[model samples]
Target chain A: MTVTTTRLRGVEAAPEADTVPLGRRRRWREDAVEAVLFAAGFVSILTTGAIVVVLGKDALHFFRNPDVSLVDFLTGTVWQPQLGKFGLLPLLNATLMVSGIAMVVALPIGLSIAVYLSEYATPAVRNRLKPTLEILAGVPTVIYGYFALTFVTPILRWALGARTVDIYNVLSAGLVVGILVIPLVASMSEDALQAVPRALREAAYGLGATRLETSLQVVVPSALSGIAAAFMLAMSRAIGETMVVAIAAGAGPRLTANPLRSAETMTGYISRISGGDLSYNSVDYDSIFAIGLALFVITLGLNILSGRIVRRFREVYE
Target chain B: MTALAPGSIGLATSDAARQVARRHRVGRAGLAVFQLSTIVGIVVLGALLYNIANEAAGLVAYEHKTDPAAVLPGGRDLAALSAPELAAVLTANLSPGEVATLEREAPLAERSQAELRRLVDERVLETHAAAAWNLTDSVLDRPAIEATVAERHPDADLRLTSWLSPAFVTAPQSGDAEYAGIRTAILGSLWVIVITMAVAVPVGVAAGIYLEEYADHTRWLNRAIQTNISNLAGVPSIIYGMLGLAVFVRALEPLSSGGAFGAADPTTANGRTILSAGLTMALLILPLIIINAQEAIRAVPSSLREASFGLGATRWQTIRHHVLPGALPGILTGTILAMSRAIGETAPLIVVGMSTYITFDPSSPFDKFTTLPGQIYQWTARPQPEFHHIAAAASVVLLVLLVALNASAIYGRNRAQVRY
Candidate 1:
């Protein structure tokens, strides 16, 4: 395609265009383009950084009131927005609870599929399943929200027994979100699995090791950090998920880890407050930013940690 | 095709036996599972399509069913009872089959009196005759008694159609299922996404250029920027919304957040406007764009750069003339994915204050916006049976749009790959 395009554009024929040893004018034009592009890129960072600062200032502004204590905001389990208090743990608890549940469910199924695609499956199986797996990514989170509400919730209630209005329960959302996040773990793990030298797989096979055992004992162990990194990435996504938690788990912030109880994640709280009427400095409203700041810190931590681990893991590689 | 034949059409069995088969016994069990499950999977796919498409077709039974005993000897006028009112009449006596069907279709966690009240509200019941009934929505609750009672009541309404009304999609969201539409929310989402991409792309790509071409990697500030970028990508998008809440909303609260727009105090109003929303979304996607663009630039063969260098080309000259063009595809892919995520994202928008009942399109970047998913969340939470059903329909639309966007991105990536 490059060959065809170069020919069609007559880039090869412009010999004199290349011979002029890029003059001052040419250099200036290039520098100008580079400068503009660089500014454009820096602007996104500026925009994002600016947003962080904005949210921080507003969230912190809520603390300026004598009534809001930093102690109450951090350790308080009861998140009563109607009162002037700013305790955020209940929502944070909900966020972490669901994320933890999703990770547990996503890790094994995703890793199995990753192994199946990368090591266990024949080429024909691998070729078809990989793209189908990725389709899970394309399906919108809102659609997954519906599927979780409609499909998974009822089945869960039946299994868990009656009175389970545990129907719009956290378990269902986390379980479905886990399923939806399968590709993230599976695809990245597949890449990491494939990155392991083929010679290792061949060596194990030569020793009469079964494919399953080889994948379990050798490939996964070698790429543990990469797999863990992918899991963390998926965890970040599940934690940030909004519609599913909103539609299925509900919008009432609470500090309980009980899957059966209706509770709000940080995302759900933000979605709820945003949709409703809120006076900006009305402490309940500013709590949305408080939650947002917390979410940002958590996710940012996860991403950097993954990068650091990946870096260290890569260093261990050739 | 494979299922119809005992042997798959393309298998080379005899040649395989002649060449390498020590034992000729076929592992036909595995083949059988493959062929059998392929058909099963297809059937399931077809069933899902049939169910979803049937609902989406918007087919409705216009005739409202009424109890002759309750309606009196002459029977009730379907036109007198709006959609919710008609549903209320049947609510007390919904057949077990009908109840089960409704339960299957309207599965929103709670089944208490409050939920029941949501559908039977004066506002909703008064307009029951005006509601639309799709395949899943009251498939059994046919509007059977459409005959007008003009002699008895001059204020009676008309029951005109049976197929899903065209108005079902164009109308803004309403408590009545018949008038429910995602148009406003969909438009709001489009505007927000457009503004988001507008702010995010140019800035993200420019940052990529600075890092790739201009900045010295050895500089501590540059390294800090790089580390933070990778870090920023990991940061939960809600945090950006928090950031927006702090800076954009608080700093400009008086102008954007409060006042007639539903605020008790101007000082408390966080300026969670569309501009702030856009900035927040830009922050969420920027890291991806920068990283992807940088990699795309790095992918350009060093030989081209060296050739230009040999000819006395400036560092910037080699990139502008050759590298930028080569990296376009990678940049496009990242930008599209980031944009798609921004479109679907509900977390930060919630943090930055998207509304649920926005009747008008966001008039400016500073206007408060209601996104598709945000509205979908609101719809899902509504107590009415019809709104719950409509949520599925709207989700289908969102899914189709997302798929189309992602598909185009995939096509773009392939084209770019081919270009290189």
Candidate 2:
């Protein structure tokens, strides 16, 4: 293919080449352009490498500190940076609570919306509603944090009693984060649902199945892997989410399951501590990097798993 | 095949009919539930906007330390006064040391009328919200609110205040929430976004072009680049902040802080400036832009490339003249959306160390800066209720800005569809 293209270009450019050696010069220029573009593309690889090296290097510094034992860092419950307690459980527990609550809110609602869009709605309805749903995704997370603090928390306090609900409880933060990720879940699940072949639905209908039966029994099951991938991706996003939890979820990390109590996630802890003045190379500063490294690995693992599930389990239809 | 008796067929039974009817009912209920799920998203959106709007404007009871009329000679109207006259009012009301400090910051006579007016508000009148109410209560329970204000603070004057007024947009940040505005934050955001676009667009689009038109999928390096970009897109934004801190703020401090250029801000001779923040944002949004640009380029028909190649056009020539023009609109739409995302991003900027209470606008990429979202985050974190009100007001402004960007992107997408 390359030889034929070069021959064609040479024949066409013979006259121009005679005047100015255009063919060889143009080929060199094309190669240069290709190299430049490749460099641009290579930046992404460099970015990933930078993130790993930066996080990994600082994390190593944090673990190497004699005061912080790796076993205690992972196994201990308390996470007081000032007094030298560097347990990962409290932050990890809070992260899980928030993400769990978010998933509880987002998964069913997102899947339902996907089912509605793919199996129930007309094209006109889908077109109008999809963008409206996207508006949810477009909203800044900081605004969601504000909503969680000023709006959602008030309602929670009014219902759960102001005394029972801390001003910066995890419940409100998680609920708002859940609301924030609904669009992600809905859109991805919708794509998965839409990808299910129409013939499956027709086959179910021919067997006298109800619309719900067809969607739930045939379409959903066939699209299960894709939906699972969506769920995983949403979970990853919730885990990585920063602003909402930082603003609404409490500042101090605590290893507790009670949603009404104040607790901080990994992300909340990072943002809160980093926002304050921390002296360079201090243990406090290095701890945030350690947490960031953990966050990056977890989210990266989930994303890769999500991608694999989608690719490996995708049903190929003629 | 054996023939079945008509009476033995279960399809005609009343029980079968009832069961079928029940199934239909269940289906209808399920459909309603699904529809309700979709509506939940819209409703949450509505609630968020309403909550912000409610806080952005309302009734406030102000407690002024000194009346504006008392500052001026013969009780002249404050708005009617010139810059120097306003400066005189500030000088007359403030201490001698305070006056000297104000003069040192800038010659009081050289200050603009607007600046002088703001100073009078900040220093002379010293007006602050003694009591505040949301728009809902202000409109629906006005009599009760008035009574509460009268009972709670008799000296304070009651009036309606829109936190998101035009003046609010142009005024600089202040220590006092009542006097604070988002001008500096807005300018900071604009500068950062300008730098973000300048760096991200060319690189992102070029990467897209390479991946779509030039990459050989058989090559492992090309495949690795593709996979790497996809993973980068999923990486948490805060991690990017850490990367920026390590790379731009620390490792490349001389360049990022403008020390290399000999233009560093004396107070903040570190890399926590607009340049570092912008570069961080560029990295955060680069994968997004590349993916979108690739899709846009992919949407351009292969036939267009083939036609160009048939005319003996070089690969770069075909891409420059034919493919790029076709993909420009879509690429622009994606870039604008990415830009909007960068504009509203707060966590990364926070990690990159944005000063929460910057009063002066950032004049260059190497200046200490704050963004609108960063300001909102700061205000919301404050203990004072009035700060929350202003935070909501800032949120409204930020939301409007985002909506406008998104609308333009939608418009561009429509135009692209029409052209195709």
Candidate 3:
């Protein structure tokens, strides 16, 4: 009797639920939701598309323009875009010089910080120091710009002699940018070091190795891939860092190798152009996009390479 | 291994043994060197903080273009006067026509007393800071500074200027470095963050939920999407700026500038509106949010879902009731971190045509805007030395805000972990 009554009630409620296949409405709703979710996920892909199309379209205009020769764009020594000397080397050189100086400053310090944090410090000390490092990491690039300009530039001037160093020199910007990436490298390297199996260290110690010998020989070697990945990531960041270089690296595309002289980076060039008032659709304007394309390719390649190194070479210990 | 060698074992006190001992000594020294390198990073961070702080506080010789006494007519310290008294002084100093125009621009009666006083400082009594020195220089070279002040502007009053004062935070940008403040920029930053979070949070979380709960890992499309998202996360931020320029500032100009919606601000019809900037920022942080949210969702134990399913709940029901709540804290943690990144970002905004000198506060998303970082960038590029102090002050503000946001994120993470 109870089953009959429930069946009757279900039959009554069925029509109110709307006509469709049995449970079709519910299934449709769920499927629609899933589709919506999938579409939402696809927005990220759409962004990549937009980035490529926008950059490619304008860059095509840049390269195809009568004023810009493709060969000259790649091989010319001078990059005076205003003067129609559309060379990529000077900007690329400045970027590399800054990245080189940054690596010199950041690599040793970042690795040391990671080693100390992961291997030497107690957990309490680690907790305290990590946040402190993060404070440095979290500072806005503009602050670092001022710091490079007002503080770092003045110091560099004193050390290199005011006459020798341009007021806006690559070295000052590079040093500060190096400081900026230290926390990133240190944090990533620390993660890599901590991931090294404790068993490896114990095995080394059991074989009469001291703590230093075990860490340097056994653990560091095991974590080399991660460390390498971290350095590459840091290098990518330094190359792309904008304001610090824009403010202190000067505005000219000087093509010279001297770190003490003023030079402009690719990112710096884009920023310098954008900061000013340029008429829309101008070749000079299009050239900034062309520079952006170069920046995008180089950084993307570095990131992919770094990611592969981390994934392919990561040691699994069970 | 060295000890086990035949010669080393036979002659433990010989050359081979000495080499082993020396190797150990060298290893120990290498450890010390590594430790010192770590100290160098810490020292650099400390020095950076000290430098910014010293510049934020300074000594200034103020040469009042117009005397404050003449303006106020009362022997009260400008800082000590009540807001109402300050307003009265402002009323007394400005010509009736000038005050009328100011009121028409933004009514003083409706303004907070602090704002009225700032107006007085700007319009009625012109206070120009001349020959400012950083705190270090102010303390160490006081005599020299004083000598210079005496020689240059003997009539000017000297004061210990903390550039990071309340007035500094409240006033808008001005042509003169002395009058410039980050008020408009701060408001613009808040607006951008609002729009960014509004767009990014829902989309990012939805993507995370789909990837974690609904995505079929066996499917090639899903796998490709997953790879794309991670790669996007690693792309340089400046590239995002370029994307913002071409898409939001140019291609989507009609929508981003509000022309399509028929709500365009005349000044920002070219799509350099706050809306464009906000949308750009939203895209910039989307990958960070999606990645973090996926990790959070992945962390939820399977048992909760199983129990819900066992009770005859559908997939959506189970996810909505159990999975989402479990993942909410983590998602929020990701959002806060994203917000922090968006706040400090300047590159993309600059590309989106963020102004260097916006004085009036933005009224809507369609209006032209600047941000704290943008203002700081502008000031740093300026030739004036006094602008550097204000820029430092702005940096202090930006850092404090970021720290607060990060601290809350840390707190939330800890709390969530404890509950689990």
Candidate 4:
């Protein structure tokens, strides 16, 4: 889906300029293509409004009519929707816990992969290594969910005990999600690491820095903003992940820190209750919005932060 | 390159030093570990491809296992099955749940219950309905698998024959595994991506074009928009979902049909409709497309634009004729990468409303639908183990589609790159 649109728009945008150098009528045709292309993209923008406006409006509905008290929604720890009590802390905690777990797990492995690809591996090795990491980027979350549920959960259970992992546990979700985030981090961090100009690294190496030191200090510092954006990207991905958590993470929302436990993140709760029969205007329905709204705010903050970090600080030689 | 060379080396001594440095950089002990991680990434990706392809192959194997007369797609192994033959295969493996639905249609409580039960359940023999259930097993043994499947009940067509299931392309999902397909997910993904391009491309390109052609980088608002777009990329997808939930689903419910699939309340479209969820997903991935597009546009050289100006072309004309084409490949690559990211996105959609089991084909734009990832989520969450295989199959479908998209985009760029 992502690949198609980019290709479509890219193809639509740039063909004529390459083919013909200059002419008034042809330029008109080019502008026409540009206009059509822009119009098409503009249409996408309007449609995109549907996502924001639709969700924003629905979220507003939840805010507009709250059957459950806001305080209860925010502060209450237990979230069993059957009785209609809507405490969001569990969802919040789940989102954070999963994000935290993913970061802890993904950072090392993703950075390692990035380092291996960007710093260590030869070009042939990097070529093979890069796309391998990239393939992870393309694997659907559904596959990851199955892996997490069938493979990861059972292993975690065996390593600890059956009690250590529930049919749907936060750790399992987090673990799978961490695997998902690894590609995000590794790919982006590799870019960030690579973006550290060879000159800068050479300057550092000229000072007698080891390859490891060159990577740790020069490359990392030089690409700090990009790496920061990558972290933010991973965080947003962790927060947004659905299938892994939905499959392996528990549906029950609980506010707690035990990694070896069952809990629901905002997404898990949405998947659980939405799939079940529910009245549209019911608080149970509205609760998803509240949770969604919370998710939106956090990820939006992170996404914007990532963009800013890249734009504000990351240097571009070109 | 010269700076990277280790200093002062006799050949053997240099080799020894290089080996030591190689060992130090990736020490034999840690090197083994690093190698494992590298191998793990490659193997993991390979496994994903192998697993998906392997699982989807089940469709063929399962087809052959069911009937000797079965013909694969694009193959003329055998002609169409007779009606009874279709019925034989469908009834043979019809699950307990499927059998019940078939009973609902045929009300065969006094008829073939024992036979049907034997076919589906090993130890189950209750009453049976002679009424036609949608399918049994592999369905090729009985021609009625095709016959009953071809019946024009709107939802009934969902029961696709294993050999020639049009439902694979057109059907919505059903609770029964045999009847289920990726149609809705495919459509949902298609629609959301289409809509996302609708949303992201223009503003993205305009922003891209403007940043490249018009916007004064010296100004604060321009800078602000730049910062905003970049930040938008970093925004958690759930945030977009929340925004959509708050905005589109809630606010646009009037425009959105309710009683979605006749399940939820009539006034409010169930949270999981395409319009709502797609819109949310669009917002979630908007910044990415725009950023990539902007970068692509920026890659176009300025000299062409100057040449156009020298020839008396307007600014727009110069950009249209001279600049945009130069950057087309880059922009396409950017959008492809962004689309990959969007397709992989689940967070925002979850926040807004993507469901696991949408049994109806989403007919209206306002109609609720489930995507592959969403359906896979439903399947994987089940306590039953077979659902894992279903999830794997769906994953393969999604991956193939994404890769196709990515590859085509790259191909377009590479092909055009020769001209450049």
TM per candidate? 0.74, 0.93, 0.92, 0.71
TM-score (chain B only), all candidates: 0.63, 0.90, 0.90, 0.67
Estimate, for each residue in A1-318, the C-alpha lDDT of model 2 and write its tens digit: 997998898799877777875445667679999999999999999999999999999999999998898899999999997788999999999999999999999999999999999999999999999888877899999999999999999999999899999999999999999999999999999898889998999999999999999999999999988999999999999999999999899889899989999999999988888888756679988999999999999999999999999999999899
Off by over 4 Å in 4: A1-75, A80-87, A203-210, A221-225, A274-280, A303-318, B1-33, B47-172, B184-203, B258-273, B276-278, B340-366, B418-420
Model 3 lDDT tens row, B237-317: 888888888888888888888888888654444788898899999999999999999998888899999999899777888
Give the per-residue lDDT of model 4 (tens digit) for A60-174: 6766663567777778887776776677887888888888988988887787787777877898887766666666777767678777776677788999899756766788778
Runs of candidate 2 exceeding 4 Å displacement? A1-26, B1-12, B67-120, B265-267, B418-420
As a whole number from 0 to 100, the lDDT of residue B183 in candidate 4 is 82
Candidates ranked by TM-score: 2, 3, 1, 4
Q: How accurate locally is residue B411 in candidate 1, as Cα lDDT from 0 to 100?
A: 81
What lDDT tens digits, residue by residue, belong to model 3 across residues A1-318? 986986687678677676665434446468888999999899998998888888898999999988798889889898886687899999999999999999998998898888888888889988889998888888888888888898889988888799999999999989999999999999999999999988888899898887778878889899999999999899999999998999999998989889999999999989888877656779878998888888888888888889999999999888
Clashes of each: 33, 0, 0, 79
lDDT of 2 by residue, B151-267 (tens): 998878888989887778888998888888999999999999999999999999999999999999899999999999999999999999989888998889899999888897544
The list of candidate 3 runs beyond 4 A from truth reads A1-26, B1-11, B14-21, B67-93, B102-121, B418-420
Model 4 reaches an interface RMSD of 4.5
Model 2 DockQ class? high
- In terms of lDDT, which candidate is stronger, 2 or 3? 2
